[model samples]
Target: MFTLAIVGRPNVGKSTLFNRLVGKRLALVDDQPGVTRDLREGAARLGDLKFTVIDTAGLEEATDDSLQGRMRRLTERAVDMADAALFVIDARMGVTPSDQIFADILRRKGHPVLLAANKAEGRAGEAGMFEAYGLGLGDVIGLSAEHGEGMADLAAALRPLIEAKPEDPEEEAEADVEIDEDDLGEEADWAPTVRRPLKIAVVGRPNAGKSTLINQIIGDDRLLTGPEAGITRDSIALNFEWGGVPTRLFDTAGMRKRAKITEKLEKLSVSDGLRAVKFAEVIVILLDTDIPFEQQDLRIADLAEREGRAVVVAVNKWDLEENRQEKLAMLKEQFERLLPQLRGAPLVTVSAKTGRGMDRLQEAILRAHATWNRRIPTAALNRWLMGMLEQHPPPAPQGKRIKMRYITQVKTRPPGFVVMCSHPDLVPESYSRYLVNGLRVDFDMPGTPIRLHLRGQSDANPYKNKKRAEPSRLRKHLSGRKPD
Candidate 1:
């Protein structure tokens, strides 16, 4: 989708307009100034025209090192990535020096810029709307993003920009791949190369260098990064190729403990990160080597496992650590004990700043994803089930032996299965775990979620046709026959 960035000074209803256009409340909105600090992108629709809409932090004048200055740089990055920009201003407040500064910056960028005089509901904003003509960008669209007014004009302004975007070759190629019947019967235990972009999400705690790692991987500062904690306030997804493989990586906000999260905005940020984790096929849990495996980190890993997503643990900032061999061993040991659900998952050490050990991390991610998508044939699965039963039979609870009948794989993408048993409810949870582990080790399926469902076979009545032979006790007593 074509990217459109909404840029303006603070408190000009940028977020309001963004939510209205995206048809969702993605960006946090408040009456307070600078409510939005990070670049937020959403899929927007104006009438039939569809494009990606980015809500950037309010432009401000500050040094490069200051927080506001970093935010401005992030907004600049958004503008560079966008196909066009919507320069918004409050009609009630008229033009300010900040507005003019940003307008000049937009003009120099040479991208199509649409000046929108926002909050112009009635004649009260008429004078200021007309005053927008002095900005020299283009004709001003008197819009009320809050009331949905002037949307037709806004749509008209966007039509040309949307139509002018050049067609992407990658998209064209994806659309042109023709499916043939011969391709469907190629192989049974076959795995094809990942032709589509691999969706990956890098996640960890606050200040764990999530964005920095991604920026290093892309070989550019595509995402805003600094030493400040919680700098990333949204789940920002960027597309680039890694070692000839097309990939889309999402840099999400750092997650904090639930009890520690008090602010509403932080809560939203955490939710967004979780959503990214769910959306991704593979999740990289970036751990700061200085403070590895905090409680929150363990929780994050567990969440990924429960979500049935492939997980890879990467210990970052290895350059600063001493005794590399010793630290690596300890990290492996810690990973096993803390997150057994993700046991045997990849644990690679890397330095996002120096770009060390990143190649290993990428390989681990691909391996885990392949394993997560693995499927076992039904005959092989049943044969493995028989071997497992012969090795260690299920324990009988309350002297009622649980009979294991047959097993078959029901689906892939985590390799789920259904075991028909005599008493499925009697199957113990420990037995289920044992089967899961055996499946992992036996089939070489490691670091992927496995599901085992037990179902009991129904018994048919034996006395349905022989009613006289199976006479009721009451009938016998009433007929004066012997109860025995």
Candidate 2:
């Protein structure tokens, strides 16, 4: 897909337009300036044209060593990577010196640049829209991203540049694969030739160093981090490679207790974090070494378990702690006591600041993911079930023995199973827990959610023993008459 990069100075609504084009609220939007510090990309469509659109941090004039300078460099990289760039200016404010500077930079790049005068809802922005023409990037197209006005004009401007670009050979090959499914055998299960990137979300309470850990893992200061709590508002996802495996890591806003979140913006940030958790295949619940296993940390871990995501616990800021071995032991004990749902889950210690124990953390994440995706054969499952029944028979309810006939795995990815029984309703919750624990231990599936469902075997017992009696013979017998 042709890539379009949206760029502008701070608070020009670049992210809002990006979200509008992509038709997803993947990027966090706020009235606050510089809410977006990282470059985020998504698939975008306009009429018949489709492309990958990137939302970049607002450009600012700062020294190369400053944080704003780093942001500028990242935005410049996006501009270079894009087939065309949307140079957005706040029409209500007119083109400022920063906009002119970025415009000159874009002009030197010699790529197609579409000058966009954003937030031009009505007559209020007419004079500024006229002023935008002075920037000399190109003809300015007035549009309101929030209200989605003037998209047709933007599309008309982009159509030519996008269509002029050549199609990628790799994309053509992917198209072939999609259409050539018939050539491949019609096996119900068709594994991909390429490995998809593992989606992992790093989450915890405010100031747990979630972003710091992700920055350490990816080996980049791609995210904006500071000592202040709640520095991160958006759930930023960045691509990464660990141990030769492709990965997508989501750095989310630190979740606070609901009662404490009085501001509307904080609520949105928390909601965004929850969305990341839902989309993640694996979750790393980071804990501050100073405050390991706090109430909020336990709540976040429990949420991940309820979501059925493979979980790994990470203790951050390990470098500050004294008596490493003793602290680790105490952390483990607290982990087992407080969050039994995640009992036996991997708990690795690391200093995201100093880069300690990252190797072990990566290994643990891979192991948890593998365990979550594990599938057991039906024969083995039934054999294990039989052994469990023999070891401790299900309790007799009301002096009637509850018979469990068979067990079969219905699915994997947090493995689920169904048990055929005489009365599924009679199966007690304690017995279900027993079976789930047994499966976890026997299958070596630690820290992953296990689902066990009891189902009654289908049967109409009255017709099983004999043929159906005729109604005519029954009527004659009731009248005391002999039937021929």
Candidate 3:
């Protein structure tokens, strides 16, 4: 597919246009300038043309090692990789010196450029639209990305560029194959012959090197990283193959305590990170070794567990820790004591800066993902439940024994089970924990959240609450003529 990078100064509706082309709100949009700090890619469709679109950080004028300078470098890198550049300008504000500077940069790069005057919905922007030609890029295409205006003209301009690229033979071959309806049924025990990318989200408090870790994994400084905390404001996802397994890794913004998150942008960033966690199949809670297992760290890990995501605890910056053995032992002890919910989850020590112990981290992630999707047979579950019952029976509350009839796995992906019992309401929380722990140990499912629900006999029998009908007259006559 053809790749296009949207680039311009801040708040020019670049992300809005990207979202419009992609037909979803994948990127965060706000009135705030420079809300986007990382590169975001999406499969975009415009009429008959299909391509990959990249939403890049706003091109800043800074050339030194400031945050804005790093953002500019990242955007320029995206332009270098993409086949074409979509240079966007705010039609209402007219073309500024910053816009002219970036246009010159794009021209020097020698890539195809498509000039768009966004927010050009009405006569209010007509003057600014005319002013855009002074930048000397090309014919300026006026369109409103927010209200879906002038898309036809935009499509006409893009069709030539998109169609000029040669098509991939593999993509064409795959497109020609037919899919079977029967294989897509709910009851079908189907598995993908082609491996899909595992989605992994790296999350922790700010300045934990989340972006640095991702950049190291991809072997490119694709994300903006510095000594500054909360430099990453978006949950940027990148696709890459690791250890022969395809993966989509998300680099999220740092989360802080709710009270400390007073700024609206920080709140948005944190919420976006949380959404990444929910979307990910496996979560890596990246912790700083210097301040390991803080209150926020515990909350983040616990949140992942409650979200039923397979988790891997990674202590970063190990190169700085001189007492490696003692620190590792102490971290393990703290992990077990603090977050017992993820008891057997992998705790890997890595230095994102030095790229040490990355192999172990990758292996642990794959293992956790496999555990999350693990399933057990119903017969095995029932047998295991019987053994558990024989060892330590359920408590009898108020002189009524809570009979556990059987157990069966209802689902996977953080395996869920249903246990039929005589009185589910009376079962104590401690017993549920016992059964869950047993399942985890016996079935070799570790770290992934296990959902065990107890169902009473009354819950299964629908007619238990239905009122019985009165005796009929014929039954009374047969019993010897009873009067009404």
Candidate 4:
């Protein structure tokens, strides 16, 4: 996917536009200056077009040895990396001195920059939209990301950049066959198709020792390690083997909390980290053992679960800790509180600097991967499910009981189960949590998202011999009955 970096001065609605384009609240939005310090990237879909959108640090005048200088350097890097830049400007404020400064930077880099005069939806922005032209950066597209008035224009502006590459031969061949007609039907008979090793992305907050961890994993300084925060500006993927498993290891920038992060490249770095999370089968979230479980740590883990990616939590800088057992217990408690969805996810303590527990981390990952890939036979799953219902019944809704009659393991790349019942929609989220816990306990699946889809029955079991079973059940009952 082509990289589109959103660059602009502070308070220019760049994050708003980013959220609009990505169709998610991935970035924090506020009417405040420098709210976004780090770069945030997302795989954006403008209708049918998919491209990577980078939300950059707000461009500002630099004061050397200051935070603003750091932000400028980061913004400069984003411009250099970007194939195109969405040069956002506040239409209500008109063209400011900062806009010219950023425009000059964009021009010097020679990247295609789309001048977006955001907040131009209403009458208030007309003059400012007009003034935006004074920056001399081509046509300014009047857009209101908050109002969502000119998204079509934004899409049109982004089309050429997104649609530049032709489809691959393999993709064309696959496309030739209608996807619906080519349905191989439940990949139930499919074996683990191993062409290459799974890509593993190790990501966390800054100074979480992401680079140190990767260096330890590969036994070399494949990535530069430093005490300074935000040292890594790019998400670097290194190829390696773990326990003889071929793998592509991606070491990503430490994700700062939204408030603290203040660089365009850091935003891009975080976005790239997310892409890796989406693309990879498993994601390892590293934490500093000293501060083992931050809110951001849990959020990263939550992202993996939400994306259906297997998660492994690694607590780095473990060697420095004095009371290892107490800290470990506290961290696990926090993990339980924050990320219940990924219950029993392997939490390994490691020192990326010393290489201690690196093997254990690899083992934990392998375990999580296996758990993620596990499949339960329908017969076994249904039998276990029946026992579960008998032990802990689902709550009734409106005096009508909900029957969870049958369950099937429809898929395994994350192990999805479909439950047939009397009322699928009536299933409470709390009870759904119960079923998930039951699935984890009964089937030995942990450290991965176990999806239980509810469908109303009279939703007959898709995998069962419904036509033959009902008549047989009746006949067996009749045969066992006493003379009346």
Error of 4 at 223 (Å): 0.9
Q: Which parts of model 1 are misplaced by more than 4 Å?
A: 1-3, 24-30, 35-44, 48-52, 80-83, 160-195, 459-484
Q: 1-484, model 4: which lDDT tens digit per residue? A: 4778998988889988888877766565665577666565665777887667777778878857576776777677777877788899888888888788778878888778889899998899999988988888878899988888888888888887667756556644544343221011111111122435666888888888887788888886545556678766555555556667876677777787888767665566677667767877878998887776778887887888888988999988888999988888888888888777888889899998889998898888888888889988889988888888888899898887888888888898789999988888888999988888988987788778888899888655687875644346566678895443
Best by lDDT: 3
Report lDDT (CA) for all predictions. 0.85, 0.85, 0.88, 0.77
Structure candidate 1, residue pairs in collision? none
**C-alpha lDDT of candidate 4 relative to the true structure:** 0.77
Q: Estimate, for each residue in 64-146, the C-alpha lDDT of model 1 and write its tens digit.
A: 68889988988988899999999999999999888888899999999899999999998888888988999998899999988
Q: TM-score of each candidate?
A: 0.86, 0.85, 0.91, 0.57
lDDT for 327 (candidate 3): 93
Give candidate 4's TM-score: 0.57
TM-score, prediction 2: 0.85
Q: Local error of candidate 2 at 288, Å?
A: 1.5
**What is the Å distance of residue 355 in model 4 from its true position?**
0.8
lDDT of 2 by residue, 148-206 (tens): 99999999999988888888777766654532121111111112236766879999998
Error of 3 at 122 (Å): 1.8
